[model samples]
Target: MNDIRLYAIGEVARRTGLSVSAIRFYSDEGIVAPADVTAAGHRLYDVHAIARLEFVGTLRELDAGLDDIRRLLEGRVTLSDLATAHLSRLDDQARRIRSRRAVLRTIARQHTEAEQVILMHKLAGMSDDERDRLFDDFWNEISEGLEVSPEFLGLMRNGRLVLPDEPATEQLEAWIELANLLQDAGFRREVKEALHETFSSPGAAIMTSTEMVGVFERGGAILVRAQEAQRSGAPADSPLGREIAGLYSAHMGEITEIPDSPEYRAKLAADVLGIEQMYLESLEEAATSTDPYTRYQSLVAIIDGTAREAAEFMPFAWLSSALKAVASLKDS
Candidate 1:
């Protein structure tokens, strides 16, 4: 009997490296069935049972429910699906943790649960749709007689914050803070007024919101790149050898009067390209980094891109409603 592969419960536990109680639990849960019973009514296990128990143990550790284990054992789900589902759930939990952390931080600052909850809700990031709706309403309120363009509307829509529904703890916190910032009456008013400056300069400014926004975004990108490259031993006069600098110059001065001379263009390009390189790096690195300012960075990028278009509409809101579609946005 000792030499035989089949064994009684005690022998099976000894050979499989499982405790008797664990084996019994698996049996009760229908995860592992006993092999043919011995003549003395003792529980016996087949060689297959040993493998099954090991698989079940692994699944349990991975947080699979008993039902999931049963379905898996029955081949109801593929391994890939099982792994994806587990990972997705884990991501959701991580987002919740981030949200909670933000709330806790708020609580810490204010030292009151009531205050924290209030702050948390405002700080929470809104969906793209929510942000769009907010802007839409705000325009409707204050965009009377404004000459908003379709392209301008598109820029605004694109700039809307669309944080992932399930974000990391830090992301959640970032969302909260950003939302709170936007929600601030003073901040919103300042932003609105700041926007007004772009359009108020004079009649026939020779630009739309889209063109304006694109210009600033391009210019900022160039500035970021140039700044970083200069720091990394690339001289300001570094021949525009990198595509980043060339692109920055080409696109930046396209809409603005930064001069068309090759030498001057190259310098402007290098200076601005440096800025863009750094800013884009920040955007790319955001997904994996635990930085609490992810939301802020994204918002800045979007705003940078939209600066020109925003400038176009800053001046007029009571002359014409040709841009009524874009002239509607709600106040925070």
Candidate 2:
């Protein structure tokens, strides 16, 4: 005891690089009590107490709470335990920060409205299950009382968008946009009409889900061919284009069991063209951004991790032009 060297609070503060009041505060808090007190009521600390103050200062610098530091100092919690808890907290904070960053970036890039900024923040922070539920409401709304087969409706429901666990900013933006589209009344009505048209057509009652899928699969292939032809500088009236159009018309005829005759082709062509125009007009009335279909499809692809460069809607556009040419009997 006589050999022990004790220092005043000022010397301890100098040694530990902590402020004198901070050392006093910790001492008062019983986190690092001083070793001795003079008759004058001045605080004095030994080497061990000064070292403990240094430890407290380090933990404080790391943002460890006072209670946690006290518990650690008291042997109530291990350093490893405190570190684990803090790491988890940090991870959660990082996700929130990332979400906020995504929202801010979207607002800046899209010139988002004040109301939409609130919406984007809410949507960007949604859990996977919550996001799934949003789409569930959409599927239920669109499929309710529709004559579409269960299998077809199942296909629609199964195409739910899934964001990655740690989604990128673009993925978050896509999700927000998609969520907005899903909730848009105009978009909902448009999808319902499309579903009704495709599944409630004349011959649809006789077509099995497999048959419908086959027809669409075939149409998709023809669409691919039309796009290829377009890329190769082939006009919509080119021989290859006409061939693609004929295949598409035949498939359309299958939808209604109408024979692939010239009159049927002309009517289908006119109807397709008219519907495209009507769709665009309706989207405008709905206050949709430019080419909402393409944007919607692209956002879905991005969220689902299947994003590709072919979201331009060019396949259908090319096919539409070909259908028009075939209707006019202009197979150049």
Per model, how many backbone clashes are there? 44, 0
Per-residue lDDT of 114-183 in model 1, one digit per residue for the tens? 7658657655534567766665655444344446555664554444455556554445555565566555
Supply candidate 2's per-residue lDDT for 274.
Answer: 73
Best by TM-score: 1
Alpha-carbon lDDT, every model: 0.57, 0.77
lDDT of 2 at 322: 75
Q: Model 1: residues >4 Å from true position, as ranges? A: 1-4, 14-17, 38-41, 115-128, 131-158, 165-169, 183-187, 197-199, 203-332
Question: Candidate 1: minimum summed lDDT over ten consecutive residues — where?
Answer: 314-323
Superposed model 2: Cα runs more than 4 Å off:
1-3, 144-153, 195-208, 211-294, 308-332
